[model samples]
Target: MKKHLIAITLILLLIAGGVIFYLAQGDKAKLAAGADTGKEPVFTAPRSELIPTINVAEVKVWTAGEKPVAAKGLALARFADGLAHPRSMLVLPNGDILVAETNSPPRPSGGLVDRVMNYLMNKAGAGVPSANRITLLRDADGDGRAEVKTPFLTGLNSPYGMALVDGTLYVANTDALMAFPYKEGETRITAKGRKILNLPANAPNMHWTKSLTAGPTGLLYVGVGSNSNIAEDGLEGEANRAAVLEVNPRTGDYRIYASGLRNPVGLAFEPKSGALWGVVNERDMLGSDLVPDYLTRIEFGGFYGWPWNYWGGYEDRRVQPQRPEVREYTKRPDYALGNHVAPLGLAFADKVKIGGAFANGAFVGLHGSWNRKPAAGYKVVFVPFAANGEVSKAKPVDVLTGFLDADGHARGRPVDVAGDAKGALLVSDDVGGVIWRVTGGK
Candidate 1:
């Protein structure tokens, strides 16, 4: 009996070793990063994985005197430091900056897969509890660094996007759209928040960050991500999700502005044509260079492919109950920012005075990727745009870099990018707890 038990144990160990070997030999990218970028990206065939590649960079906070490298002819400075996990920023009408210093809400435990992912995420410096507040930063002396930092709004639930429309500030929390009365030059909001709309944030909210932007007509557009990766949680679980919603702030009524976006994190309106645009994080586990995250014009009542298809009708066999009809209407994205870039923030350069190549374009904050080998997108990039509000054919140009050290340990991870009143770019580094300012040469 003892010999038999030993044989069984040895067999189990052999099986585990085999599984590890297979996962270690997971799909690799044959094409370079730029090959899967720009207006005509080369999409490779999907190489789905039973266990996706997990190559998260261990977090290492930046020491004093350390900062990101700006492009040639540009300068980088610390706008605000020593803050909680800052995710997004909004430039108030009075030139004050409001940053949402928050993190993910408490997530319920799943099975073994989720347990492993949680452990990896924590190691990547994203496990901290939500700060649940927006902090105000004022650079009153005009020296780039913030002089007065104070709590602007407190006791909120993982707030992210913020927009001021018609004297009211709209905050998109993880599960609801909140509104508060506001006035110019005020540092704090003592008024009670009104819950304008409840967003889709059910249990296991895989993508919980809701980005808000105001349209030209005073309508509010909110970017709601998918409940699950590729809708594996059943179609019923994705009702009104994976799409951008236009909300009426007064009546709390909303409609699906566009459908089939996997995770639209950043929304902005083009300055020239006033067309709404968004940066979408595409589906993962399809190898490293298959599906590229994209920036595209958000047309009303339009559909971009999600679970069923990708990159304009490239069918994903893994998604069940395939709707072949949906492929006919899948709108091809305008520009590909590269696969697994994880773009989070989008701001046009209409107000940005950074000259030369940075003159006419949009700034994107790439939050970095955990699934891709060699790690991609821990920096800020600028995608050039034409004068007519169309995306140029040029590949994205790096604006800020060196977030990772020689050992590939992440010193910081950028989350959002917005232009300050003085025409400089403000980048929120969530992991390093700093907001970096980038200005062009004099």
Candidate 2:
């Protein structure tokens, strides 16, 4: 009788798994892929799922001679290769490049849901252990490729963002902001990093990556993500999170500069107006088309809706004890990059000499999506900005393609974008472990 009972339970579990797989596959995207992109995208009604759509592209790293397709009149070449999940970058004053080859820290197992999500992420080329180091890539011969690649700094905790200010290098690790003294043309740093400030990095850090940038006034800005998706862990856990914090490097003091940005992974300053801007990844599980990720100018003390509202006051009814009043002050983003594009990098085109339509715009690295079916955003795109440093109503132009192959497998996934000393664009492909240089064609 015990044997029979055990057999029956196993069969039931299999049946349940099959049912879930069917439901997940059945949640097809109703709107077209790029329909929810641009200044005013179509906001379809919410189609929340008990099990959100799980359409992840399997990872197949590029073999020899494989490369992404550049846009018309643009040339592509490998800048540096054989990296380990290079997520962010900083080009030094002396033309040396620093690549933060890192990933998420170890996460505690949170029952079956967390385990399942981990499995899915592993399949999507994101489950590897953190590299915990930053590498220096130097091109001494004047060629585009880096002939000297060496470890610049080590013993970090999933460092993501990097900046050099006033002869000091600041790195945003998953849990702390660290600083190290540096000089021009230094290939490596052997000194220990001083902890400038502690960031919000509680356990099960859903959005673990912290982006950073230095303003002209020498103040540092760090972007911190929320602890939970839609405040499921309660609002208390999100204190000083989901916002950008301004820090004084001299004294280690910091304050919340802006609040309620869900996951501002990429922080940059517009050269013309000198205003801060960011690309945010919105909430998930609202079907494939509900919440569109955006790029916008981040104002001081500004609030872009998160758990309470989205897209300029569209309430997300999922949160318990919703703050209906929060909608009144919710600021809409300037431009939407479509739903679940997962933009992770933002760079202005002010110093970029890649002429033509790419001259006066912003280059964004859309890291691609896993929660939405008919996945979006595996390439880099250019969003044109006006002469006054404002993003226009025009749609984004694709700058790099072919990350996803014909069979929907990802050969590479773009993470961060930055302009090099020579005025060319450098894109980091974490999955393929390469930095690609895009320049004007001959």
On lDDT, the candidate that comes out on top is 2
User: Per-residue alpha-carbon lDDT of model 2 for 34-92, expressed as tens digits?
Assistant: 67888888998888777877788999999979999999999999999999999999989
Model 1, position 120, has a per-residue lDDT of 68
* Superposition error at 59 for model 2 (Å): 0.6
> What's the CA error at residue 267 for candidate 2, in Å?
0.7
Model 1: lDDT of residue 171:
99
The model with the greatest TM-score is 2
Q: Candidate 1's C-alpha lDDT?
A: 0.90
Report each candidate's C-alpha RMSD, comma-separated, in the order given.
4.4, 3.0
Tell me each candidate's TM-score.
Answer: 0.94, 0.95
Evaluated at residue 162, the lDDT of candidate 1 is 92
Give per-residue lDDT, candidate 2, residue 50.
77
